[model samples]
Target: MLRIKRLDIFIVKSFLLLFIGTFFICLFIFMMQFLWRYVDELVGKGLEMSVMAQFFFYSALTLVPVSLPLAVLLASLITFGNFGERYELLAMKAAGISLLKIMRPLIILVCFICVVSFYFQNVIGPIAQGKLGTLLISMKQKSPELDIPEGVFYSEIPDYNLKVGKKDRKTGMLYDVLIYNFKDGAENAHIIYADSGKMEMTADKQHLYLHLYSGELFENLKSQNVKSQNVPYRRESFREKHTIIEFDSDFNMADASIMSNQATTKSMGTLKASIDSMTHYGDSIGRQYFKEAMGGAYSQPSGLSKNDTLRIAEANIASYNVDSLFEAATLMQKQKIISSAVSRTGSLQGDYSFKTYTLETNDYQIRRHRIEWHKKITISLSCLLFFFIGAPLGGIIRKGGLGMPVIVSVLVFIIYYVIDNSGYKMARDGKWIIWMGVWLSSSILAPLGFFLTYKSNNDSVVLNADAYISWFKRIVGIRSVRHLARKEVIIHDPDYSRISDELNALTARCRAYVNTHPLRKIPNYFKLWMSVGEDNEMKAINEQLESLVEEMSNSKSVTMLTALNNYPIIAVTAHVRPFHIYWLNLLAGVIVPVGLFFYFRIWAFRIRLSKDMERIIKNNAEIQDIIKTNNNL
Candidate 1:
């Protein structure tokens, strides 16, 4: 028990180390992006440095959910890889520690992480985003320093264009400033050519002043009366404020986006307001429908029978009147009132149907948001899945190197990420049920991880080289034998009257042919060809014999008899029924007999040539002996 505890402690520690490292690494990368995005905006607006810092801080907080799952997966992979490398898992297994036992502490750690992630998602994340939005909004109104270079037109405004020949940066003095103003159809609208100008902020910085010196403004009026008169000219000084010019409304609180859900949860009052809004809209629709049913209530009124019973019944629904005419008119007016109410009620009912449909749509959205609301927790739980994947994969591979495991882990993670992200999109788009889309990836990989883990735990050799190796061994252990006819051979007594003389003669002939003629150019002394097995070689040799037979037939000079002399080969090959296991009773036919004949013929020719040389040597020696004998005589 103590030893098991120690192992669990070690595994947990490793997981924590890897998890924390990946978390910080991913956090740092996201933080850098957050800084880059807002830093320039802050500087451009001349906002206080503190605002930029706050922006980055809050932005980083919002990005946590996206980074957490990726970090968890990376961490689990590294942790398990380390264990597999050090052989600690092997050691634990040898000691009879079950896989489930090893996973106990890890699962507990995942649960703890999941809880923390949930808290972060629900609490810290929304608040941080809200604060970030507020900070950016506050900075948008601030005026930035304008460094207008000489001899270039600066179009910072949407419709107006300005060019300054030169400017003193320190004094904010402008020289040779030219401003072009556009009009809704004023031909030659207006141009202000100033000798010099200077800019200054209002005491409260609510406005900017461009004071000009001795500059003439030209305006071309299209009116004939004005055109015939003197052209309009004036010395101009323009003043505008940041408020008059609209800046982007982008960086606002986005409170509606962030707080609606939070508000929905806080009190019944908030939900009641949304419900009431929907209810009110429903009532409006019902009213329209009711009015449509009433003849000409919502439409133009048409003259109809005033004495009709339904109209009369509805008409007399008023206080007493003077006479018949007045009484009828009053009654009709009263009927209209009742008709209006009925019309409103009918419209309200239709509006209610639409509202119900919309509410179902919203409900689907809310269910989908269960994942978004708990995104961090859900993503963090993926750590358990990854742990299963990494741990088992490491065991199966039994390799500790970063190269292979990292590649494998990345591939697995890519698949997981693709599925998860795809499901999320489908859910968001209402294409799939929220539960299926949000948890689909997890559902898939979790079981797969478990199966792989179970397999690894059982020490099942999922991939082994033995099966292939055994096949090769079987192939190597084969040999081939030619089918020899069962004609009995007996050595006949050296007399001609021997009964078995014919058999002996045939045996001698076959033996002489085998010995004298070698079909192959060179024999494989090692007989490694036999290692290829008898069946395969036999097949090959038979193919060669068949091909030789065809060649012999094509070339009439190359008879089977001549082939037997050149290439000595023999096979007791018999034909078998197609696709059948049974063999046919067939005699040992002469296959590639011509090749065997050539083989023996060459061997005999070479042997004879050697014997002839020996004879010459013997003759020379005999001649020498005879000469010696004669000389002695």
Candidate 2:
């Protein structure tokens, strides 16, 4: 229950943040739209005030769906991002809470939101869109406030055009109004002339009242002329009282597109019927292709050719793939196209229409439309998918400052967007199955997010300990191997230079091998005990090394002599591959031998000096045979 409450709080907070932020942003966009549409008419064309107000209101409603999903995504990200940044996620982890346990409530909230979003898509969204469309149409038809000068006439309204002059604002009156109302046929159309008139809009702005002091209405309804007889004509004059012209009903509920809810998609049943019809047509196309393959006398063709019966079957397949063409067209329609107004009409050629017509007969359009419909449903469901991905990712990247997290989120989203759009295009072109195309990105990303989250939950220190140590050494001027104390007393006059030369020779051999193979290069200095050469290399090298250590001991390097006497079983094993370069192994081999040898040499010298100092203190006998070996340079 406590867990449930926490999740509830999270979701509510996320939704509110998203809703408020998106609403203001979308509202501003809608206001700009309203201004752009009627601004020219309002300023230049002198359009009225009421139309502008209605336009904005309708525009805002139509833009809700587009902004809603974005708001939801942003809000959810911020909420979880804040939690992760604050180290609350770490605290939760320390308390032994599983990631899934933490995210459970959030997922439940998203599910509820999914239902709400679906409702908006199916119900409220359509109504708002319909109203917006109707409002735009009305704005196009309605005239703004007439801004005629004192004594000039203007004629711009088409079909039954009017020219009025000398307007009086106080009485809403005008003089010399010439109205031209056309009859059925332009050959015998009659016009009306009014000497003076007063115009007033009704309360609802539907009807117009014309109070003409003197006016004549003429009608020239053409009749069959019997051998040069005059055509029938009628004329009527009106004076004094105003003539009320009732405009068409302004607010017919039935006239609103929303009243015919299924106009956008005829019916839910129609979509189902369309799916069924397409399936049947696909089956029929398959049958036709089969029948076409079995040509007369059933003789197999020697080679593939368009004229061959099998080739005809293939052409039939291509023709049946007219569905792909229709699907492409449907996608193109859904994608907003930019074209000049002058080029819009009659742009679709006769051949194009005929091809479309034939395809429609075979249920091509319905299949294409079904693809679109499914794509939309999938896109909407993607919101839920992204939420899953984002929430999990946030928990994982726990270093959630705005900068890193936001950058990562945006990059992920960009990749997702590109993939999803590519899939959508492929599906539209019939290059991919509808479900596969629509769901591909989400399917790929969701698993990736899960893997990342799981990896993040595991305890692994990402920083390198060796690297940190190296940095410390560089900073403090510490050497890799520190110097130790020396030893006393000389035992053997060993050729120390010869042993050193042999060590160098062995190192050079390793280097040469490394140069040739390039990948298997490691020193084996400690392997003096392992060599079984015909020259007894191991025994000779060990004896030479022992003698060099004895010389160093006599020179009072105590550590080296103590090491040689205490631990004589020195062994080395080296292996190298041509393709694999294990650099750390190479480093270890170089460092360990060199480091230990120096330390032992120093200790042996220190021990020798201590023994000489003790002999001097005892005053029993002078220290003798402390001879240093010289190399033949």
Candidate 3:
């Protein structure tokens, strides 16, 4: 007997419940989409309920493979996100449970799901596909029961167009009816016009009886003589006319074997066999084409003697240049030769076109079969891939419910869907190899799964905005310092009145300098735009602030010392400011985009510096006030 842990049971219970709901929800959505594709065939045809039921059943089975992976992805994401959101994950971690250990039960369940999905894909998917395909064919071939509308030409019947200007809804009476009967042939059609008419079905529903009042009939006599080039027409006017039109309105089922050879209808074994056979056939065709393309060199002429053949083979093609020959020929000879050449070219072109069409069709068919083979396995494996992706992503985000998880899942799946669809199309169109295109999404997303898993396990703050901003500042050579004292330090209160006055003066001077700064003008901006140079103005302010902070840290009051310590060391950089290279303006004008971007960066930096100086001045004033109060005490 095997023992199961309570933790495993608890986690499995949560995941299973969510999985069941999500799977059914996904199935229902996909089935609705599937039904929409054939709604035209299913509706308005009076199809038997049994046939409709059969279609829906098969459609559900066919859609399972597509829906399963997405369901797993959503369920796993939501489950983990819930754990993280409720701090269940934190409690588990506190209990010495690693994320992987906590996820073990759910992981096993997901792996089991993947295996079941593969079984369905390999065993059941093909049969369901076959049944659905047969249903589609039957629906297409089954002639729809007639329901002719007014003001539209009805061409449902073979080779005939029936039109009625107005239809009486209650009495089934048609007014101003015209029928173009092209059953004999379009060129030899029989035209009939009536002021009023009534249509009725025969008891067996095999034929339609059209009873018209006050009608004229016109018949083309060309059908009587097959050799007749000219159409002889006969018209007759009658008070009453009756016509019997043959139309089969029965919902007949088509043969299932008609769709057996398609990619969707084949089992894995059958698909492999077909691919092998097709590959061999393609190779044979290629060899034959190559032989033909090798021309007369490899295929000897039948009438030539050995010596004559040798001479012909050795002869230069330029010696018989057609252009020169035609130019030198008499007018009559040239006309005859040109006519013969044109006729021959037409025949060859037609032959090549037919051959090209055949080869292209075969090539695409082989690609489809191979793609299907890859699809069966890849789609099954996607269940596992998606789980890893969504679980780790949810863990990292620590957001639950439909709000964040749903948005993130949708975005990730959309990216995969777009890449997958594009690659499949490229492969199908012969722009890429079948396997490479089929696995393109997997290739990109598999690595992403690994990365997310690693980050989640290590608790990396990969998505933190402040971390990224700090990194960006560091990369761009901007300097900063954090203030955290290793131990408590007491500050001795000193010259509070003088310090306050000096702080006030510093703020005033900094403000004044900012407003009167030479680099604040447009001409200075243009100069900076063309070159990168150091600004002594902001540096002077930063140095002055730094010196004042150093002086303030020497106070004996602990509160004042701590308050001063809380303020960070500040530095300003004008990354895109003016430089001393006069000739660089010419280069800046040459590359307008780079010049403008650097110019903007510098301008923004200057503004930030101006703000930073004012903030520093204000912060210093507060420190001075704190020191002054402590000194008075």
> Could you say which candidate leads in TM-score?
3
Task: Provide the lowest-lDDT 10-residue window in model 2.
Answer: 570-579
Q: Each model's TM-score?
A: 0.55, 0.48, 0.72
Global lDDT scores for all candidate models: 0.57, 0.54, 0.79
**How many residue pairs clash in all the candidates, one count each?**
35, 34, 7
As a whole number from 0 to 100, the lDDT of residue 356 in candidate 3 is: 85
lDDT of the structure predicted as candidate 1: 0.57
Q: Candidate 3 residues 413-518, lDDT tens each?
A: 7898999999999999999999999999999989988888888787777855678888888546465754634345545534667777767777887887777874
Q: Runs in model 3 with CA error above 4 Å? A: 1-4, 38-44, 151-153, 159-198, 211-243, 288-299, 302-311, 319-336, 464-633
In Å, residue 460's CA in model 3 sits off its true spot by: 1.7
Residue 625 Cα positional deviation in candidate 3, in Å, after optimal superposition = 6.5
lDDT (C-alpha) at residue 102 in model 1:
79
lDDT of 3 at 192: 97
Residue-level lDDT of model 1, residues 1-633, one tens digit each, is 787788888888977887887788778877887777766666655544566677777777777765666566667666666666788778877888887787779878876777666556567776776676666656654445555568988665544567999888887878888877664344555677878877665555554456777677777655547446565444444442111322232333333354444421322333345545655655676576567545443333456454554555565545654456545666778688679889988987876687677656655545444546434445767766777777677666666545666677778878987998998888777788767888888899889888888887897766345655755543332223222222243242122123123323433443443455353344322231112222343344335444433332322222222322333232222111111121210111122354343334434443443343333234333433433453465
